[model samples]
Target chain A: MNDEKTYALKSKRIKWFENPLISEDKVYWKPKRAIWFWLAVLSFAAAFGVNVFIAPLQETQILPYRIFLASAVFLLLSLHAAALRNPFLRAKLYHYCQFIFALGIFLSVWDLLTDKTSVLPVPYFPSAASVLQVMVLDHALILKSALYSLRLFFAGFLTGIVLGVSSGILIGWARQWDYWLSPIIKVSGIIPPVVWIPLALSILPGSFSTGVFLIFAASWFPVASMTANGISSTPKKYFEAAQTFGAQKKYLLFKVAVPHAMPNIFMGILTAAAFSFTTLIVSEMIGAKAGLGFYINWAKAWGAYSKMYAAIVIIALEFSVILLIIGIFRRRVLRWQKGIVK
Target chain B: MTEVLIDIKNVNRIYRDDAGHKIYALRNVNLQILRGEIISFIGPSGCGKTTLLRLLAGLDKPQSGSLSIEGKIIDKPHFERGFIFQQPALFPWNTVEENISAPLKARKIYAENKHKAARYISMMGLAGFEKSYPHELSGGMAQRAAIARALLSEPKVLLLDEPLGALDAFKRSELQNNLIEIWQKTKTTMALVTHDVDEAVYLSSRIAVMTSRPGKISKIINVELGQNRDRNDDGFIALRKEILKELRLASISPQPEYNI
Candidate 1:
C-alpha cells in the first residue's frame, strides 16, 4: 500500500523540465518548471502585450491593462512561493493557473471584439475597463445593495435551515408525524416558492417580509426532505445498540440519529443554498428597492449595461464565497467522513 | 449451585420471514443463568442463540413468556444488563472515550463516574486511543472499545452476541483471553452467543447447543474441566469435539415448517 501510494504520488508529479540523461531515480518532477505554469505566464504576457501595443478603436475606450498586469505578476509570484511546497497548495495552484489561462484568453477575445474591432453590438458588450470603471464609481451603491441582499438572504436562509432540520428530524423519527407531515411536505414542497409571490405580496405587510418569505419557502423543502431522508435511512442497528445501552429518546434522536444524518443534512443545505440565492434575486427583482437584484434591474432599465454586468459579477463572487464557507463547515463537522467519502 | 441471575420461562420469540410466513425464532426456551457464571450458546446461523442473547439484554420481548433478571420482569433495556453486539456498534461520531462514557452520560452519572472511562480504556488496552474515532480504530480495537463501553455501565449481566465473530483468528484468541480476564475481574454474569465450538469449550462453564427453524436448545453440556482450562489439553479437545458433534447433529435434525 505504501509503495502504491508513492507510485500514485510520483505519477501525479509535474514533469515540465527534466534532464533525461539523469538516472531514473534521480529525475524528479518539479512544479517550478511545469509547462502549464509557463503557458499561464505566457498567456498573461500575451494579453498585456496586445493591450499595450494595440490602441483601442474608440477614442473613449479605457482598457483594464493595469489590473491584468497586476494579476499576472501576482500569479507568477504566488507560483514561486514556498507555500507551493505543500501538496494541497500546489494542486490548487495548478488548477488556478489553468483557470487564469482560460480567463486571460476570454479577456483577450472580449477586448479584441469590443475595443479593437467593434464587431459585436456596442453598449451591450462593454469593455472590461468600462465594467471595472463602473464598479469603482458606483462602489457605495453596490456595497449598500450587496449588504441589503445579504441581510434578506441570510434572514430567510437561517430560518429555513433551523425549521427544516428540526421538523425533518421529528417527522422521520415518529411514524405518526410522518403520516401527517409527509403528505403536506410532499404536496407543498413541489410547488416552486416563486409561485407564492402573488399570494405572499398581498398577505405580507411589506415587500421585505414577502422577499424573506419567498427565499424561506425556496430553501425549506430541500433541507426538510433531505434531512428526513437522512434520518430515516440511518441503520436500525445503531438505534437498537443505543437502546441496549440505556439511551433515552432524546439521546437516540440527537446524539445517534442526528450525527449519523449529518452528511445528508449538509447535502440538503447545499441544495437549499443554491435555491435561496436564486429566490433571493427573483424576490428582490420583483419588489425590493436596494439590493443587487434591484441594482441590476435598475441598471438595465436605464441602459447602463456596464453597471449591470458589474453587479452580476458581484453576485457571482458572493454566491461562490457563500458556497466555500459552507464547504469549510462541512469539512469541520464531518471530519470523520473525510477519507471515507472523498 | 449459584443463585439464578436470569430466569427465562417458556420464552417463545416469533418473526415473519421474507415470504410472509410466521417462524419461531425461539421455541419453549427455558433456562436459568446463574449469577457470576459464564455461559455459551453455540449453534448454526439460523439458531436462536442471538435471539436468546437479545432477550437477556431486554432489547426484545418474548411472545408468550417472560424473562426476569434477579426476580424482576425484564421488558425493556436497562443499564443493569450490558449488551455487546456482533458489530462493535460504536457511534461513529464519537471517540472511544465518548462512546464508553455514553451510557454513563445517558444515565446521568457520568459527572460522578467520569474516571471510569479512562479505567475501562486502559483495561481494554486502548490507552492511547481514547480520542480516536471508531473508523480510525482497527476492527479488533473497535470491538474492544465496544466491550469497554458495555462494561463501563457496570452491568450485572453482560450479554454478548458473537462479539468476536468478525475478528481474525489471532485477534479473536487474544480478545477471548481478554474476555476471560475481564470476566474474572468483574465477576459479571456473562451469556455469550457464538458458533465456534472451541470458543464455547474454552470460555463457558456450560455450552447450550441449539437447533434451527423453530430454534430450541437441543442439549446442554457441563464442562467439568475447571478454571485453569487448557485448549491443547485432551480434556478440552475432547469436550470441544463432543460439542461440535452435538452442533452437527442439531443442524441435520428435521426442521419444522409452518404452512402459509
Candidate 2:
C-alpha cells in the first residue's frame, strides 16, 4: 500500500479515545467524570461544614444563614453534576437543593416570629419581608420617584445618542473636524458631570433639566469616541468597492459607513446607558429634589436605612431591566454577527 | 471585437515615504485592453498588477501620463467600471439582494429596473440566498456574493484583484470555472490580477507577464486556446512550460531602473 493509504488505515484502526475524529458525546463520562464527581463531593462537604459552624450564632437559634450557605453548595454541586453525562440526574439534584433552601428560610422565619418580641415583626435582618414593608408602606412616593428617574434616564440617553453619532461621523470622516473637535470634547469629557451640578443649578430653570443635562454630558463622550473609532476603521475594501459601484456620497455614508460602523455604535449606546445611569444618580444626589437617587439620600438623612436600601435596590433593578432591553436590541440588530467570537 | 476599451499610456506612480525615500509602485507602464477581452496580470508578489488594474478601473491616478476609457480621460471611477477584491467586502447589515441592489439603487436605476437589478442575484448563483447576510455565508459563497454585487452594476469592464485567492483549492477551482463561464456569457471587459500562473493562463485571452519589485510588463503572451479549451491538452502543457520558463527568467533578472 502507499504511505497515505497505510496512514489512513492505521488511523481508522486506532481506539476511539485516540481518534481526533471521535465526537465529544461518544466519550461521555470517560474524560470529565472524575472532575465532576470531585466537585460534587467537595461542594456538598463545604455546605454541610458551613451549616455546622453557623447553627449557634443567632439568638433565636435559627439556621437561615447556614441554610443559604448549604443552598449555594448544593447549587454548585448540582450544576457540576449536570455538566456530566446525565442531565436528568443533575436536574433532580438541583430541585432537591432548592427545596432544602426553601425549608431553611421557612424555619428561620418561624423562629423569628415566635422567639422575638417587637411591634414591627422581623425588623432587623433586612429580609424579603422588610423589603416588602418599605415598598408597600411607601408605595405612592417610591412609584413617583422611580418614574421620574426613568424619564430623566431616557431623555439624557436619547439626546446623547443623537449628538454623539452625528458628531462622531463628522469627526471620523473629516480630518479637520477631528483635529478641531477632539481636544474640546476631551477637556469636557474629563470634567465630571457632578462638578457640573452647581453650574446646572445656577443656569437651569428646573431640577429635572439639570439631571437630564448631567446624564447627557456623562453619556455623550463615550458614544462619540466609539462611533468615531468605528467610522475611522470602516474597512478600506468596502469604501473602495462602494466607490467603484458609483455610490454617491450620501449612499456611501448611509449604506457602507453606517452598517460597517454599527457594532461600535451599539457599543456606544451601551456605554452611554451605563454612563447615563451613573451620572443621573450623582446629579439627583447633588442637585435634584426628585428621582431614586434623591429618594435614597432623603431616606438616609432620616435614618430610614430600610427605605434607603430599598430605593438603592429599585435603582439596581431598573438598570438591570434597561440593560436587558438593550441586550435584546443588540442581539436582534447584530444577529448576523452571532457565532463570531473575538 | 478588437475595439479598444482602455488605453493606459506611460503610467508612472511614485510615492515618498516618511523618511523621504522614493518608492516606485509602477513605472512607464503602457497597455491597451480591448473591449470584451479577458486579460490576466501575473507576477511575483508586490508586482504592480493590482495598481495597474486599479488605474484602469479609475480607482487611482498615475502621477504622469494618462488613462482613457472609451476615449474619455479617466479622472475618477465611473459607472462603466466595477472592482472586486479578495475580501468579499459585503455590508454586514444588508442582505444579498440589498448588496446587489446597492449599485443600481445608488445610481437611481433601482426604481425603474428593479427586476433587472434582481437578475444578477440569480446570475451569480445566489438565487435562494437573496435575503441571506454576508456573515451567514461560507468564504466561497461570500466571495460569490461579492461577484454578484460587482456584476449588478452592469459595468462594461470588471476589475478583479485576486477575487478567488482566499478560497480553498476545491472552491477556488469551482469559482475559476464559474468566472470563466460568466465572462464568456456576459462578454464584459475584464482585468484579473492573480499570482497563479495556471489561473492566468486558463482564464485570459492574453496573459501579461510582469517582473518583480517595482514591476514592469516583461511580456504580453497571446493564448491561442479555443473558447472551450481542454486543460489536459498538449497545447496547454506546452504553453504552461513556455510561460514557466519566462517567469523563472524574470525572477532572476536584476532590478530595472525606475525611470519616471
**Stretch of 10 with least lDDT, candidate 2 chain A:** A20-29
Please state the Cα-based DockQ of model 2 relative to the true two-chain complex.
0.59
Off by over 4 Å in 1: A1-35, A59-65, A78-95, B16-22, B255-260
lDDT, residue B7, model 2: 91
Per-residue accuracy of model 2 over B69-98 as CA lDDT, tens digit each: 888998888768988888888887888888
Worst 10 residues of 1 chain B by lDDT: B251-260
Cα lDDT tens digits, model 2, A1-342, are 356434533665653233332223332324422444454445445444533543432233224444545565666666756644444343334334444445545544443443332323333334433454577678799989999999999998889889999998988888999999988778988887678888888999988888888888988898898888888898787878888989878887877887778899999999888878889888888878898999988987886766887798899899999999999998888876875634
lDDT of 1 at A174: 91
Compared with the true structure, the alpha-carbon lDDT of candidate 1 equals 0.84
